[model samples]
Target chain A: MENLLEVKNLCKKYIGFELKNINFSIPKGMIIGLIGENGAGKTTTIKAMLNIINKDEGEVKIFDLDLHQNEKQIKQDIAVVLDDSFLSEYLNPKSINKIMKNFYPSWDEKLYLKYLEKFNLPINKISKEFSNGMKMKLKIATALSHKPKLLILDEPTSGLDPVARNDILDIFQEFIEDGEHSILLSSHITSDLEHIADYIIFINNGEIIFKKSKDELIENFGIVRCDEKDFKSFKKNDYIKYKKNKYEYDVLVENKADFKRKYSISVIDKPTIEDIMLIYIKGEK
Target chain B: MAALKGLIIKDFQTIKSYKTTILFMIVLFTIGGFLNDDIITFIPVTMPLCFEMLAMSGFSFDNLSNSDTYIRTLPVNKKDIVKARYIYILLFTLFGSLFGLICTILVQLLKTKNIGTEILISDLSITSGAFVGIMFVQIFQIPIMYKFGAEKGRIIQLVMIIVLMLGISLATTAIMKIWGISLDNLAVMLKDYLIAVLGIMVILLYILSFVISRRIYERKEI
Candidate 1:
């Protein structure tokens, strides 16, 4: 697949937190979901890739152009939605339209107005007065109004109810329908990713733990529930990770069908994204 | 250029509420001018100072909203951001001086009903002096504000003003003791060249301030 963004060997260091060899790519016409716990470097990774923060070492290429040599040109096609940062609280949507008209050459004033009407956002009211969901919708509307090809968003679905999150997911899905646009969205809400993301990159402790297809994680990987005796009979190599309870064991299997064929365990449960993340973070190796 | 315009527009929108306060200040200044015509002399100093405060308020608002971080992600370079801020300051300073001059003219016309070239000349000198001094102070304050946020920058500005006061006074005393010239005599002697010297100094301060601000912002990991 043709890639929209490619980040390699990205690294950044703070007093206590660091991103170690962070790397990823967003293929054209696809959504790549970035998932991690709090302080897991998801935001840091996004910031570094966008050049909002200085990276200690790395190379970032967007639209097949070197970031340092072509930042302004590349950024023309890129849109960003930060979790806690935005234009300003004092600016109403109308004023924002005026300010943004000067930034992006492709800024569509009519489309922005349409987005406001469609979302029922007030052009006269400042963003500070908006509820959490409304604020998110405004951010999305602003982001899309520029007609950017690549959208890099951090925690776009957080602090949203199910209805709002679904609305946002629908937007993301629609954004990439042209088969040339792409989105990199970071959210801890795994279920949302399941709804739209084609790929998932899990970051843990400032490092990328794994990057897999959504179907691979959802369809192939599973959990085997069995008593302690059955767990004891299974070899250590049989399961990827196992968790022990008082009277039973839950083993994370790489392939449920193969595990079933090799062992007599008939209770292989299909794992959700959360189940996979929980096992990856808490289950024993 | 588009990026610079966008940044300026953003700052304007950030401080839009200050328009009412500015109007209030203008009214108060006008009232004070009517009560005492001598207030006309202070316009060049006070009006410019108020505009400076308003410009700094933009920085405070930017810090509050975390807009700088968001702007960095845009298509603007750090150098251009610094340049836009200095340009905004310059424009505000020029506007302030113009406003003060116009107010001084109108108020003098209303009160005395005759043109006073003598007082106008004196006020012009004071205006030039205050404008140069404001630029000097800004050259010092802006880089500090860019390095630290506007909140901490204000405290540092206070300390810097105190130090500058002490330094200027001591330097003045030493110059008087060495040259044995009265302050008024020295002023008249140097009056011809003061504006020229300060003009050059203002230009240099702008360059230095812009360079320092750009360096501070480029290295900043926002």
Candidate 2:
């Protein structure tokens, strides 16, 4: 399948932080979750892909069209929701509807009103009076109303209760049900990604640590806990990285089935997305 | 075209949202018209001064809402954003002129005091001066705001307006003194040729400003 979005060797440098040679691809009809610690360049990468910020080096392609050249055309079919809803506080949804209706070629008034109703957003109330969840929902409603094929959401589910988050996730699931739409969602919440993500991309500091399918990550990745003597006996290449405790060493291996076959005596346990990220970040070679 | 319309519509909605501010300006203009003949004659000048305030309000609101990032995500290009703002300045000027005209007519019909042809000429002078002043400020201010953002750009705009106003006033005084032309004669000279020159200059400045702002904003990081 053709990629809905692609970022190749993306690089952006700041005074103290850098997005270093970042790369990722989102296939059509799939949700790709970007997970990272704060200042790990997740926002930077998203901004680069969206051309919100100029990338120092690299290329971004949306629907196989070069982003910089076909920006206006490509942007028509793409929707973005930043951390801030970015709506003027004084403008109510009614006014916003009138303003935004002219912005997109495929704007669906019925869909927008439906989302507003489903989200329980007051049509006449200014955005200033909204709760954070309501603000997020408003943004989502606006994004989805335009009939975009690719949705780029930055921390959309952050700061929401589980119910709110689930509601949003369900909307995303519904969005991709047509098999023609896709989402690139960045969040710190690992469980949210675990529940809805098809592929998980982890970034640490400024670089991509790994990008793997959720099933492959869940089923194949493992943690091996053993004494120092037993840990040293295993080949150095067997595990990607390891953390040492007072009593034993915890090793992170990519493939549990192969690792277990090679060392039948060592115990292997399944690792969660959080566990994998922590071990990758906190553990050392 | 639709994207540009959307942007203009958004800014118009923003202006509408500032209900208190618009109401206050209207009341102030109406009261000024009722109390003083000079105020009625200079309504065009005074109205744009209000619009300058309106422009400032728009900038602050854009910053407050973080609309720059949001606007970029739409189908509109950076150039379109710049164009829309220029269109907005034109719309604001048109609105101000219309409001000033209505008040001038109200002052004429409702009051016993009538100044005849001299007031008409004075009104023209004031209207031309206001158009030049308002456009001058916007031409310099928009590009600066695009480059530096609303906060620092506003300071630059204030300083530039002051400097430009002072310089124009001084230049006018010096020219009149050197040429031995009375104030009325000079106003006549402006009515005949200077308004046309100023109008052309304003258009050129607006075009230049649009280009410069588009460049600044295209390169700006959200």
- On TM-score, the candidate that comes out on top is 1
Taking the tens digit of each residue's C-alpha lDDT, what string does model 2 give over B1-222?
Answer: 999999988888888876687678777877888898767766777777777668556667889989888888888888898898888877887677667766776677678566588767766667767877788788888888888888998888788888988998899899889989999987786777787888899889889988888898888888
Instruction: Give the TM-scores of the predictions, in the order they appear.
Output: 0.96, 0.93
Model 1 agreement with the true structure over A168-192: per-residue lDDT tens digits:
7998999999999999989898999
Regions of model 1 farther than 4 Å from truth: A245-247, B179-181
Whole-model lDDT, model 1: 0.87
Compute the lDDT of residue A169 as modeled in candidate 2.
98
Give lDDT: candidate 1, residue A130: 91
TM-score between model 2 and native: 0.93
Give the Cα error of residue B50 in candidate 2, in Å: 1.2
Docking class of 2: medium
